[model samples]
Target: MQRFPSAISLFAALSFGMPALAEVTADDVWTNMQAQTRAMGATLTAKQSRTGETVTVEAQTIAWTLPEGIGSLTLTAPGFAMVEQGDGTVQILYQATQTYRMDLVIEGDTATLDVRMDGATPHMTASGDPGDITYSVHVAGGMTAAVSTHAPGEAPVTIDVVVEGGEAEIQYRVTEGPLLAIAGQATSLPGRFDAEMQMGAEVAGTVFGTVGGAESSFELNLPSDGFDILNVAAALRAGLSLDLKSALESSDYTVNLDFYGQPFSEERRWSGANHAHFSLDENRLFYDASGVDAGIVMKGENEFDSPVDIAFEAAAASALLDIPVSGRDDPQPFALRFSFDGLRMGPGLWSLFDPAKAIPRDPASIDLDLSGMVRNRVDLLNFRQFVGDVSGLPEPELISLALSRFAMTGAGTATEATGAFTFDNTDIETFDGLPRPEGAATYEISGVEGLIDTLLSMGAIAQEDALGARLGLGMVTDSVGEDQYRGAVEINEQGHAIVNGQRMR
Candidate 1:
């Protein structure tokens, strides 16, 4: 456990000797918001609302730096207001009369959120809509701040975020609610959600990097029934843990979902379990994520029109991804690996696909391992600057890519492959109108001919299509066993393609 100064202490340290203003105004609040946001490499601009005079402040665009030190972040919204209290505290509010929309982007992640709230009193009601919403903030002491949001209804909700003693805490609770407008239509959602989180050193470091190590945990629970959307009763519980150390970041999480429904007057049910653990550490200036494991399990009835039930389990899935920060002029190391234990489908489902059970019903596992080097490095700040501006922009590039190792394995089966390749900037016409590749690869596959024949006999594939597929396979493969074939492909420096030691082009 590590100790950090409270929010007040951090503020005081940053604003040492600054006088406490006797009066707080919207401008002051906006200035403070901008100052804090800028630390995260974000820009926030305010303008007049387009709706009416009642709307005082509208922040058009708020963009920030992306995590993993990559790309950019953008958040677009059309709401918010600045208000001052007699106690000199300021509040930022968001309430829309019509539809409320927020678009958020963090690197490759993106989400668009829409919400509506309705309350009974004018003070509780928001600007655009008729929902009762009360959002406010106050500085209780020199080092403590409290922010709260409330919505009154059949299923009332209250959320509070408090920052004190160098830590930020969030708490949320919602009671079972009735119907609320969804996508402009009234929809019933009889459910409740509750969650709590506390930010410590690790979380602060990960977000701001101005702090030291941090550790954080999150828990959530949601149980509901009478949901017509999926025609089922559903419940979910999840927990997550995160940590950021000097040169490493790690996370562990798990989630469980239970669902119940009726099929043909019979009760059908199922449960799903998911878990994941991963960690990333800095290797000098570069970073690598390894020892990652994730899995999922589903056991229940096939509630749909399918002819079989399901008892699937996919466990022991693991992966590794390496990122290089070497300059563009130098080739950077890159690699990726992924593997899964097996995929197990229930016997009933397997039988539905093959009544005679020609193929083995046992679980099938797959693995892929690849390692390579490439040239693709871009300045983080420069790339972010061009995210929303394309003209005269300089993007990242891969001038050269080389794969030193590539392998795929199908456990419990005679299906496997291995290969390597290299590509440079030089152009070669015989290489599919692209830069020609140099290297060779070999593959071994068994039971494929029998599977194709079985599919044809079972009316799964047309005879004409089957014949064409066989002819194509014959062009590259040599039969080595009853149902096994060996194939090799090579691309020479002179842009010639060789199949099984025979030059084709």
Candidate 2:
């Protein structure tokens, strides 16, 4: 146990957001808590176990101090002593030969509870029912804990384990403060393989949970066959490793690359490292996938015949997509290859932004390699229609929903339209049908109001109109819920022009 601080900070502050402050004396906080817990029929016990590590507290006697920070207590009790509490909230302070130790501190009203685990900081907290308790545990230099559910008297089970800082950061919670940027990377691939990565990320915002932050370079490598079955067959042999590195947010934008792997895709691997850093406040992104030589089949032959030499830094440039990302999702380090039929991805991308911006003035860009083959229908379609337009080219019989082939290499901007733009196989693109000749020209969104302040500056759409259209987009849809997303789209011969989707006309 050590001497108590004059300020009585208790490591940190905690609360359950409840509006009740039941008063308990310092003596009650110590003994009364256990009595109340036992009344709950909980099997609570305290035992002295030899921990391999040393605790920072000097281990003084047990007692509690007043709100004015007067912890000087001369206890005449054996070992330790303090005040017991009702409502299960207890405070225990201890006094050693020359030092003082604090066993616990409980607040009866706030619903929020926190317990210090032998360390210098509070390790756990509880609120609401016995079903759950929140924690802010620190492992190494980071803070993590689980959504602890008590289940009445269920041996105190842990719901989820979240480690942040130097290891893992759960949600918007950081192990360290904004001063320490979380710099770590994680990867997951096929073949029963998984990986966890760490990155250096620094939050530069306020404690109130606002947006705008920065990250340092993060690196991670995992074993997998890559994204699609198309890459699995030829990429099974490993001669390289995947590395995600050099990440930062600068004045212009935030940049990062998924490029750590072998130099060659042969049985002999090299280091495939993708690294970068970008300016802060820039919500645009550009990706380069030219090194990946594999493609779909075209006309029963391998039309993606760019020779699988595997030495590709493949694009002249990348697109700067103005997209807003939550700080919680940035360091997550996740990737998936699951594809769906008629999966409209346009709205999903649009959803990433604040609803206040309806049309992005800053055009988003993308570059890629799509010189592949497909034996069946059209390569890709714009959102609102089926795969059409093949009268000038050789006609292949329409059989299964198998894809057609095409050679594509260059850059294309996402037109002010609502449709997922693809740089690779057009098969991933969607086309329900061109819009009707006169049903609706362009649907305007209204009522979004101030939901997209940041988006307005990113050039996505005008702030005034964005306010008008935001929520209304959902109301016009067919369903309601997390998965419910819809937009009345229009189409033309060149492609489909989107409405509530984007272009957002």
Candidate 3:
């Protein structure tokens, strides 16, 4: 379903780039579209016919092969017409209903999908010269898509999606270095989707969902040389840069499943806004995503001989990753951050484990922020060859690590730590074939004793086990205040593990 819109957008963008009206013609636009498509390593073919001021392209087909011979994709479009307005502009006209057929092959399996796009009062116009052109597209009466997918030895899945309204503006420029610079912004009104799936008599499911609205924008720079859609690595190596960002307002969905006479269902809703960003260049790749005020409710049967009725509240999460892709002699910097907060399980779930409410029902959270430098001995782009043969290639060397923040809280207990370290790759033997890391970290913890007591009272742990836990805590940490403990762990230059000045090695 998503592929349909993406393919249409790509075709529209490439089809509308034209020179100034004084030098542009219907045939020129058609020729440029085919040339651009070929440049991207895709074959676009159609029958062209011109009458008066309009040029029509029909029976259009696009074929593209996936990299590594993993798969192939083919799309067939009904047709469209490009009308030269004689006012330094071109008006693109689409039929009330456009049917697209896509075929995909992966490994030894194959799948086919047919999509019908119904548009009401859709408008698209293109202007400007070849060096810089602007295209405006608007669908005032909204659009709808009906998609049906078929695969071998599997039941067909049908999905229907409806959008209330949408609009997009695109700018295409040809730069001095023969690079194609493209930027676009788009917005869509509320949308809804419904899907149904059925396998054998024992398996069936239905999905219904609604999206509030969304806005997205992207910028891409593609060099003319080695710009092949089927060869993404080569394109990146030839200086391809892409950045994309999107924000979604809200969404709600429900899924119902039946398996072997057993029934299960789930409902989810999220408010506020969710954001995502991604960028890729020759040197590195970066991604960041965050969501707010989300929740889920599930009902089913569990192995504990209890009816399952679980719910979570105010669920939110954020994650970020930045890493280098190409190998270099010098160490490259990388960072990762992930955290989830505001997670509170429903009482029905808590009662299964703590019937007496012995433990605090506090919302749980985990956070980690780490940055480091690594020297790559092999290109990460070609990392698949070394996946199963660990000893066949030298691994990336970790130079330094900094844990600016680490925290976890749940079950009436909380813990936090911070640390920085540098690794000695030349002295791997000191750590038994591992890089020796030298650094000191400090930690603080609270409410552990009460938590252990609660567990013991609930018979979750043995009395001797509780005693041993207390003894270990006493040996490693000191009580800084009531219900509070502080400690430090260090790996010194001599390869000694020291806890509170006591060396263990």
Candidate 4:
């Protein structure tokens, strides 16, 4: 429904009246991509290849307009040359030896592009799949990367956003045969990355033939995710900021955020009827994400690091869930509500994996899977942590508030238990009572531990914090031996954590 200028006009403008602008960031890239696609009615991928180059794709059946914008490209590799005469025309040359491809269009605050080398394996692999991978990248509540979504009802275009340490992959079935499927994975995470997304939004996709085991994960690790959601949001139109922090094999990233406009969509809803699966491996997670809104069907996997084998439905909603504020007493008013049913998530949560103070994997335990909620409010003006109000919910979907002193719950298959005893529950058949919860909560604590020792050691706890001597042992195999003890008891529910008996969210 949006309109963009023509490419000819854009080139003309840039040829003459340029400059008088500012710097560009990842967000700018996204803003430009979306705007250009809307204008040209085309699908574009920027940063899919090396930077400074643009490539256009004519694979899908679609027409798009170009926008008016400014771009400075410093093409390198195999020697490049550019000449500008007194006139307005310019001559650029590239060494024929370097066979790369680039297509870009800039029109009125929109930039869409596709850059690729002559030969690419991953791109050729994910021919047809569902979902735009660019959507998966969420830089944890900070400046997102740059890119845009091609409008729906248009010819679906596949883009490859390959940055220094980011990769986007996706798979869809365009074969038009008995089975029409679409799925994939994406990421730009480096183990060294200490990224924390207090507020997060990102989109990425990939085609995963298999979803299990360390090898599968190792395969995924080969591909990293790039592009930040916050950065892209800022580029589209409303120039805003986002907060993001990350570290990778050889890269580290950081971004402060203040996002505006629409925060993209928040539903990881992948729709493809026959594309469903159910998996349970390491960790003690149980998920069943199958359904229209949840996903195409029930299918999930667990990292080999998990001690127990787990499986569940794909339609099952997130045990730990967040509700969108449809309407509020006051947009800036000081009240908030959060809830969860059964959450499965990554590590570093409450340092549950730490050997020093984590729980054991055996006797795997957790009962408040039904539902729970928390309703609280505070002076938004002050904006201090660990301080708020707590209202009650009629009935909660989950209820694992704290271990004893203070603790919080999250979602995921594996987490820190009391001590260490990899849950020996590979019996997918025996697993039962898995729930799709709907509940609410209202409470607060400070410096809270994810779970208790026997709570963890006796297979009671399951959280990810500073993995140490034990989840509850209060000590771990200090790798650095610097005594870098992570004595965190922070409290956080909704947006804060509880530590000790106080609030340290």
Candidate 5:
């Protein structure tokens, strides 16, 4: 695949205000586009939804350079010529045959270029092999680009695959910058813009056998303020210090991906509709995306020769991620928390594996709330320093880890578990070289025996393995009453293991 910079950066170049002049030549516009594209960077924002769950990703522009001499064209007298039109526009044309032609028009602040080749042979750069390909690119002004390609012959092309009617386009406009520039006036440093991309493409050959009709699309509303754009340029130069908080806070977006295949097929769509938010104070970052809604459906043929379909939905679905950015000792303590609500899946996905249908087929749902902290001078910001050169990294050390909350509940089965644990860095012998654990964990489970019996009857586990597993379980667990089982495991500073109020080691 040909990699390009994210759509946001492309839009930044596309939406830049043109200079105030009576006329702009096609070559002038083309040169400006090439130069601006090379020096530009912006935030790429997107959202994805799958089965009632939505996720948002905001990233700095990817550093991708176009191929050498990509925009250069050869012109000659008559065969290749530029003519001034009555409308104060210049039209450049290159024509040799019906299958090969190039046309470009420039008027006022807008320019358009279109190149097409049909039934032409493509020569491989290395082996000099011959293949047939037809492709065209249409650029409207600097804010929109569209490309289409097709290969009807069997010979492999430069991409090593045969594609059918692939098409893609990008369009954008400035929303917060100066809309018009004065003569001899310099453009401002930053602005806000809205951009969108519509693309559909498919290929099948030695690369991916026999797949077709795969497509995807994206839309973004982004900001390129002074502070963020400077940071983006710095990252392109030094590859460091990415400000995640600023990117997410700048925009709202959406994305969709769909495909079909022999063994499996998937469809996912999601969006963040102006409800995404982010904040950063020094080395602490807080993110909240409460307005995201998404869902996903997957279907495939199971190994048992039976078809299976699984789907999930979430109403009131939201995702959150919080992280301490600086070292733990930097005044603000280190902490982490991740959680979600209204997650559900089911109606016989498990039945494919359980032929006897012993497991419940009702819709199963889950809710989770987990949080923790690490006490040490560990610097999360310094993590990137070791990516390509680790010799400068500091010595690794452990201070302490604490779990403040661990809570989860499963609907339809009435199962719930809650626990907490803390570890001391100085006492590694207590938990076999792990930070000596100094806290207890408690769990409660229902239908304990029936589940085990059903698994045994289905021969999912060997008899010997089951016996060993049961023996291990018996040492750490005790029945509270009835079919319910409750147990607690704890480790002390002296390296002692205790279960259910009894010492085992």
Candidate 6:
């Protein structure tokens, strides 16, 4: 998904624009695009012919080499025209049905993409100067891309994607002090995708899906002084900032698989809204995503001569992460959070394990929230060196950790804990070459005793095992109420493990 933005930025280089002081000419737009393409370490070739106020470009090709000599991408288009509007603006025209071919090579494998763009009324308009330009694009009939991938000693894969009613507005500006700023908004009415794969003789699969609608917007500020599209590490080190947000209305998909004459299938659907956000800067990186009301159903056959059916639903799910990206002398702040709420399994799935309905069929949930501070001592932006050899990198010193919340609830039982800790990096020898942690944490649990009893009654656990579990619980936790227990653990200043006020180490 992150690659999508980078690909859009690459295409932005080929967009046309000019200054507002004078009537923009076709030649100006073409020259600006060529220069921007060259800046990104890509080659652009095209032949131009001018007639009156229109400039026609034909046989256009753009080729870009991937970093580390890992792969390359090349796109070729038939032709297009740029018409001067005589009012400091230019109108870009495209054929009603435009076809394009893209060739890609990764590692030792190759893939080709055939793209078809259709529009009942598709058009683009560009205005403003070379330093600041605004472009608007609209495609009524949308676009479709079919990709065929071939790898050695593997089955070939083909994927087809279609997007409908697409539109976008973009703003590009050259800011002061070697910086390029870009902001854009895009929306699509609906989309569909399909993929098929076949192996030798017995294995094959197909996936088909559709999305209701989607909208996205993004802003980026990239260092232009020494910008190379292939060198993302350099851009990050030079202080790149980007913010991206997107949302989807709904989505659903179905997958079918066949293996050695056996057939299996699964269907998944998601309703309500789904949203995601990602942002990155020189100092830190952050990302968040959430979904509402999702479910899945699967069916297959097994050796028991019985058909297998399983189903589950989730009311909501969300996750968030924030971490520092650059090294700093002082500790930097970070946080992570994840949660899944209102999870319920269908009776078919539950009956397989609990045919007598001994266990409660209640919705389950889990959550975690953590924050920490750490001092980094290595330059993470040195990508090649960091990937080639990580042993030379100094270990980051843990400063503090806070588990604000941790919880799980299901099957008539619940458990939760909270804790905060600070580390002593200077006294590593006290903890055997590791930083000593000083903090206390407490936990509460309910329904464990009753659940164990029920399992014992159902013969799920032997009597001796259940007795041993009860004895272990009694040693660690004090019974606070019926079928409930509470306990606390601490790491004292002297590096002793204390459980319920008793020193254990």
Poorest stretch of ten by lDDT in candidate 3: 14-23
Model 2 alpha-carbon miss at residue 69, Å = 48
Q: Candidate 4, overall lDDT? A: 0.25
lDDT of 3 at 279: 96
| Model 2 C-alpha lDDT per residue in residues 14-73, reported as the tens digit of each score | 111111233433322222233322222222233222223211222223233323342222
Models, CA RMSD each: 17.7, 25.4, 3.7, 22.6, 15.8, 4.2
- Please provide, for model 5 over 437-471, each residue's C-alpha lDDT reduced to its tens digit, 9 standing for 90 to 100: 66677766666455566667888877887788667
Give me the displacement of residue 248 in model 2, in angstroms: 16
Per-residue lDDT of candidate 6, residues 233-275 (tens digit): 5687776788888888888888888887567554555566899
Better of 1 and 5 by lDDT: 1
Question: Residue by residue across 207-304, what tens digits does model 1's lDDT show?
Answer: 11112112222211122121111211111111111112111122222222222322222212222222233322222122223222223333333557
Q: Arrange candidates by lDDT, highest first: which order?
A: 3, 6, 1, 5, 2, 4
- The sequence of per-residue lDDT tens digits that candidate 4 reaches over residues 73-183 is 221112223232223222222332222222333322322333333211121111112211111111211111222333223433343322222222221111112211112
- Candidate 6: which stretches are off by over 4 Å? 1-23, 35-40, 106-110, 119-121, 141-146, 151-154, 159-177, 190-210, 225-231, 258-263, 301-310
TM-score of model 2 relative to the true fold?
Answer: 0.19
Which whole-number lDDT from 0 to 100 does residue 54 have in model 4? 26
Residue runs of model 4 more than 4 Å from their true location after superposition = 1-319, 330-363, 370-505
Give TM per candidate. 0.46, 0.19, 0.88, 0.20, 0.49, 0.85
Better of 1 and 2 by lDDT: 1
Query: After superposition on all CA atoms, how large is the RMSD of candidate 3?
Result: 3.7
Q: Which stretches of candidate 5 lie over 4 Å from their true place?
A: 1-275, 290-294, 300-308, 315-318, 328-348, 375-384, 387-392, 395-415, 462-469
- Model 3, residue 5: distance off in Å is 10
Per-residue alpha-carbon lDDT of model 3 for 205-265, expressed as tens digits? 7777778667777777666432545345556777778888888888888887777756755
- Report how far off residue 97 is in candidate 5 (Å): 27
